[model samples]
Target: MRGLTAGYGPVRALDGVDVTAERGHITAVLGANGAGKTTLLRTISGLVRPTAGSVHVDGTDLTAAAAEKIARAGVAHVPEGRGVITELTVEENLRLGALLGSARKRTERTAEDVYTMFPALAERRRRDAHTLSGGERQMLVIGRALVSGPDVLLLDEPSLGLAPRIVSQIFGMLRDLVRETELAILLVEQNARSALSIADVGVVLGLGRVVATAPAAELAADDALRHAYLGF
Candidate 1:
């Protein structure tokens, strides 16, 4: 996105922002609360429209597109809080993901692939989503998005309240997914240290704009930036 600007009422959540996510790479967007990290992903996914700037994927402009249109364009968004359907069984929830606009064929094989990616969900295929732990719910949500065959995945604060071990496990899988599937991930997280450990690149946002953009290791190594924005 270039020159992106968005807001709610008179409050500008995003201001003249520019960012990019490459295939097979993980770009971590880190900031404190209310720094516009969530707003960045929301604008990209069309949940919120940008007042200016263009959101282009492979040369197709998606800035003015609707949320559904953007999803069909292979940009899937997993909002904060896991966004799982508590009433639906694991399999039912997975099926809902494929029901959306997707270019690939949704077959039993595809369902099997999702189960393969998340064995815990497979074990609880018949169980309601709310029965699962926080980490399990997170995996289920990510696997559901994968079922849609999206090229770009925008994940918001995925490590919110999970244990460190669970967070590590999930981040490890995300790195592997990027390498194996060549999908681009834009990870928004308050867990700067964890996010930088696995991310290929990092973008630090402050107030409503980018303050730093660099290689993940470089960003982590910068003492001033880390202390000022990363809270580490």
Candidate 2:
């Protein structure tokens, strides 16, 4: 994105922000609460229109495209709070994800691959979504997003409200997914420490603008940065 700007009426959520998500890599966006991390993802996903500038994916401009168009273009967003339908069965939710790829022919590989990646989900496929635990719910949502077969996965706060062990397990799975599929991920996270631990690249946001952009290792090792922006 170049010179991107977005807002709610007069309240600017993003101000001339510039960022990138390279193919076959994970680019993490980290910031404090209300720092426009969610807005950035929403803008890229076409949920919120940009007031200025452009958003391109694989050289195609998407700043003004519809959300469905964006998803069909292979950008799947697993929004904050998981957004699972509590009334639906786990399998049903997975099926809904398949609908997002409605133009493509349905195949067993899609569901099987998601189940293989998230075995816990497969085990509870018959259960109602509301019955699952927090971590399980998170897995379900991510699995649902994967059913769409997106090239770029936009993950928002995947670790929120989960225990440390569960968080580690989920992130480990995500890292493995990245290595196995070579799928690009743009992760918006508040847990800077864990996010940086798995990120290939890190972009730090403050007051609706980028404060730092660097390799994960470099960002993790910077003491001043850890103290100032990351709250470590």
Candidate 3:
């Protein structure tokens, strides 16, 4: 995204946002609540139309395209709420994601692959999604997104409302996922420390604008920046 701008009605949540999530890397978008982190992902996924700038995957321009069109273009967004079909079983949820994925990915990444990635989910494959714990639900949603075989994965607050151990497990899995595949992950999080620990690069936002953009370690090491914008 370059010079991306979007909002809800008159409130501009994202203003002139410039970001690039490269393949094989995790770019963490860190900020306090209402810092426009969610808007960034929504705009890129075409859920919120951008009033300015462009969003492209590989080489195709997808500015203001339909959400479904963007998904087919290989961008999968796992929103903050750990969204899943409560009525479906663990395995069924993954299969649904694969079916909605691009035709090529349906064959490339299957539900079995997701089960392999998250063994906890594999253990509960037959259970309904609503029966899982908070951490398990988070894993299930991410696993479902992975089954889509997206080139770019947008994850919002994956660590929210989870224990430290569970957060570490999920973050470690994300780090390994990018290392093993060409997939790029744009992670949006209020948990700056956890996000920076696994991210290759960091982009900090404040009041709908980028306050800092640098290597994740550098940002993590900056005491003033962390306290000022990151809040941890």
User: Top model by lDDT, which number?
Assistant: 3
lDDT string for model 3 (1-232, tens) is 9999999999999999999899999999998889999999999998899999999888889996899989988899999998989999998999888877865452377777777878899899999999999999999999888888888999999999999999999999999999989899999999999899999999999999999999999999999999999887
lDDT per residue as tens, model 1, 22-126: 988999999889899999999999999889888998788999999998998888899999889999998988888887746633322266787887787789999
TM-scores of the models, in the given order? 0.96, 0.95, 0.97
lDDT of each: 0.89, 0.89, 0.91
- Summed backbone clashes in each candidate are 0, 0, 0
Q: What is the lDDT of residue 115 in candidate 1?
A: 81
User: Candidate 3: where are CA atoms >4 Å away?
Assistant: 104-107
In model 1, the Cα lDDT at residue 88 comes to 94
RMSD (Å) per prediction:
1.8, 1.8, 1.2
Q: Which residue runs does candidate 1 get wrong by more than 4 Å?
A: 104-109
- Which run of 10 residues does model 1 get worst, by summed lDDT? 101-110
**Runs off by more than 4 Å, candidate 2:** 102-109
The TM-score that candidate 2 achieves is 0.95
lDDT of candidate 2 over 90-145, digit per residue (tens): 99999999888724323322777878878888899999999999999999999888
Candidate number of the best TM-score: 3
Rank order (by TM-score, best first): 3, 1, 2
